[model samples]
Target chain A: MAAVPELLLDPAIKIWVLLPISIVMVLVGILRNNVTTLFLSPKRTVPNVRLLKEQQHLGLLRTYRRNHHVFISQSDFDEKFDLFKKEYEFDNLMRHYVADPEKLQKLKENPNDFNTVMSDLSSGDMMMQMLKGNLANYIPQTVIMYWVNFFYKNYIVMKLPFNLTNNFKSMLQSSMNMIDLDASYVSAISWYFVNLMGLSSIYALVLNDNEMVTQITQQTTQQQQPAPPTAGGPTVDQLFNSELEGFKITDIKSCFTTIHDRVLEKYQ
Target chain B: MPIVNPSPRQPIVIIMSSNKKYLLNQYKTSQYLNLSPPNLLQLFNSCKVFLATTNKLSPLERQSILELYFYLSILTNHDIEAKSTLQKLKESLPLTSKSEKLAVLESYYLEAIGSTNTSSSTSQEKKDAKQVSSSKKQETILKELEEYLTQVQTLIVNDENKSRAMSLTSQQAGPLSRMTTNDLRTIVKRKVALHKSFSSIDTYVNQLIDFLQVNTMDPFTWNELGQTYHKLGELTKAHSCFMEIAVLQPLNYKNWLQLADLEVELFYSGDLVAFNVLNDSILHYLRAVELCEVLVDAWIGLVVALKLIPVSEMEKSGVNSKLKPLEDLKGKYDQLLKLAAKKVNKFVELGLVTDDKKLNSVKAVLDDTK
Candidate 1:
């Protein structure tokens, strides 16, 4: 193995190259958060009432499945279960808007009809907001990377205080083409990358509950778009069927049947 | 300094007993507290004082204070203050926002106005010494509310249309300026509150059920439906509604107490599964007491429910396979009776139960169980 080439650059590189990139990145991140907040309106779009009802109904069924043994009697539980079953079969959930009975039946049969489901649940407002969020996320990083590359392309900005193995050479020393430079020495581009990722703590100190900042910043780290989680997932009918399956598997055990025993165990 | 003020240094003992707990505390509204006229006035004044420094508080704090002020003003029959508070809240909170709290407040405001209008007309009738135009005035009052109802209906229609247009055009969905399900429920609640006549309550029950069908998990609507059932003497329906609340919020001592009271009623009425429900009532009371150890009423209730369990059932060895045999279960009952007696005695000693007759009755019941 060859020894690393001893390279002592000017100390002024720390003041000129490193500080400017770090400070500019932090300021740009803060600015992007505020700009996104201004660009995206605060009002939440109301979902369709029938879809809302269906979602809430499914939630109630899930609660029942979890808590059948708590307080409800077997007869009452069965009655409610039978009622919900009948409603599910008839697709009474979307009765208000869905006029065609055949289409409703078809929907119940093939719940993965993505086109129909998407049309029913999608909101243009959400798509637009997501677009704006992506723009806010990518535009700044691109501009910052270009600015750093154009101005301080080949400068070795600073040496890390701690040593890193040669495995980090590709990451920490990206633009500077010196093969024997130790991996602990960070270049201008890698410094920008480090500042981009590591300045979250500094951003946290500067920002408050301004959620727009987090939403935009999170998109860069977490590649998953904050498209409404339910959208492009399982259709509502599919969710209903799955919840029904959960409800059906659980047997009703009323607390009344064993209350005396429980009380005795506690008191005695 | 040498004398040291030595006069037999006494030991300082701190009693450190728990404070008497209520299922519904002082923070609840006057309606729940059943506050008298003078106390209601005092509460209204204090709430007004809190409202004066709204700028200093956070947004959530300001909203809560404003809601408290609105409820107090309406209950205290201060029409001017109530109207102004409602107007102020409407300005601050978007009318189409999906918050049920605002919808409930608006319904209450409408009810208050309805009552005041009727009362004023009645007073005018008394001054004129005539009852001839009473029906006419009633008609006018109905017209006023109906006019407002039409306005709300039109708003709902407009919201529906806007949503349809958005769905078609894929346009930038405007702000959450849409009529919520709670808004519709609020209209029905206002109708129920104003027309306290027998027939409208039946319709209100149907409307509330319709609302609950959609928003199944809303505790507020469930509570409202339960109260309506209770008013109409449908104990079974009311029991189920209160049961939902108890299950939804198991930690809430008040819901447990309500359910237990209903169970006791159903047991006495012979409408429930007899022995099983009595045991359930005892369990509920035990839960209530567990939550608030100083709850004397729950102790009394526990005694009542425990006594109602037939001796024959307790003696049966094979009633439930999960339960212990006769001797052990019977001993458990005896232990529970002793526990209730001890708790009631402690409450009396702590000056919690001031009424002598009620105390004696509770003690007598506990002693009988023993």
Candidate 2:
């Protein structure tokens, strides 16, 4: 009776306690392995993602170089990266579908079926790969490490996160009613900051309006000064007056007489 | 310091000094500080006093003082004062023998009058009255004569001085004397006519003819006589003057052109005898064209004269002889038309002739000629 009682001790309770404890232990072990794999494992590193992104940016620049007319600097490159990312994603997706024309034709016929198939295939492939590497034992640690790298690449020095947060808040407000779950808020935030800061900084560095105004004012003032006197020549005022007097009206009939009189008076 | 009695010269000097100080104060206030009407008038009065007291000064000094007075008067809006100051300055200055001074004076007077007319309240009626006054007209005539005479005197003096100074005295004097004499005669004649003293026009014309006889080979002198005769309304004499010029210098296109114009005027006025004159004018133009075939005016005149020729006479004149003049004229016209066509082509190439109507009109004209 005592043995029976021990065996039958609230089956539900036993199941809850023992099952949870075992799951936790397994989880702990998996986390430990994941940590090692993410941080120290040699095989997890991908060689081509950075190179791919760099090549994508260069391709975009080449496309615009002949026809853009505007000069693009390093800052402009940062601004255009998001657009490149979208184009790259679409191109990659197209290439993936092009590799399997049967799947693409199925997709063209029924998009839902194609999506379901792809989702299932990708999930199955991920699980298989994870199992092959025994990364199921390291999933938690892998996630943590992935996050750490993301932070280091995108949010170190706090600027990236701050801008990202603001952009998220703006998008949340602007697209509050939109039901798109796949839209990337982080990418939007990055593009917003790049454009705003890049344009303002360039304008500040290139155009010095205050200095130009001062130069113009000084030049205008210099030109306004009166001309100087010359040697042996009558003063400007004297010459002006003498010219005036030479043409003045005197007695109508005796004008030359008056001129003669005036000339003689000065000589005398 | 006040206990000692001063001499009369001391009081006079003291008065003058005090007056100068007052004037200086007024000038400073008017020019720099305030510039009110009363202050300007005070400056003008002070300048006037300065001029009156400074009688023994040189013409240059007097000129400077008068200039100051004129400026002050203008600032004060005192036209009468400005005029008087200008008159005194002119009187005080020595006259140059050259016409340059007179010309400068005339221009200055005109500018001053224009400024006053614009700024002053003088009515249009008053200005018209002044312009129409016979005395004013005579005054203008006299001033012009004086200016012309001054030019003649300066030219003569300059020539004489040059002759005295140069080793090539005879050579220099001959052309210079001849030119100077011609200029003097023209100037005198113009001066007399400008004064409207037509009583001596015939005498002047006779004098011009005599002077032109000396240089019968000089086309310019003949042209001058022709112009003078034309001005005097002696068309026959003018035509003869140009004809003589055309005969002497057959290459002068203007002589032929003028002769043609005079003959055309006469022919248009119903003088059938003008046909011979027209023929003579065309012959001269043709001769001119022979000298310089590129003369465009000769070609144009020849075309115009051909239109005037009686059609009955066309056959009487030899076929080649009649066609030669027309062919030469047409050739020149074609050359001009080619230049015009080139310009029009450039415009067409530039897409400047956007209006279809204008483009069509130009094309039609070009096609008709073709």
lDDT of 2 by residue, A62-128 (tens): 4333222121122333343344345444334334334677666655555445334534434443333
List, residue by residue over B228-304, the lDDT tens digit for candidate 1: 99888898999889878766666776677778878898888889777667766777887777676666678778877
Which clashing pairs does model 2 show? Answer: A30-A137, A34-A138, A245-B86, A262-B91
The sequence of per-residue lDDT tens digits that candidate 1 reaches over residues A36-148 is 54444334444545556776787788888877866545666677777778887636654543567887777667756644545444565566555655566678889999999
TM-score per prediction, in order, is 0.63, 0.27
Off by over 4 Å in 2: A1-268, B1-139, B147-218, B231-233, B269-275, B291-297, B311-370
> Where in model 1 is the C-alpha error above 4 Å?
A1-47, A72-83, A94-97, A105-231, A251-268, B1-36, B49-55, B87-107, B115-143, B149-199, B313-328, B348-367
User: Which CAPRI quality tier does the interface of model 2 achieve?
Assistant: incorrect
lDDT of 2 by residue, B1-370 (tens): 0011222112111122315445545444333123444444555676777767765666555565565566566555566776776677666645632333333333334333432233453698567756676666546545645564556645654654443233210111111122232334334334433333322457556756654433334465577678777887677778767755644554465565677777766666655454455554455444444444444444445545545644345345533221134444434334444443444455556555555675676565546545
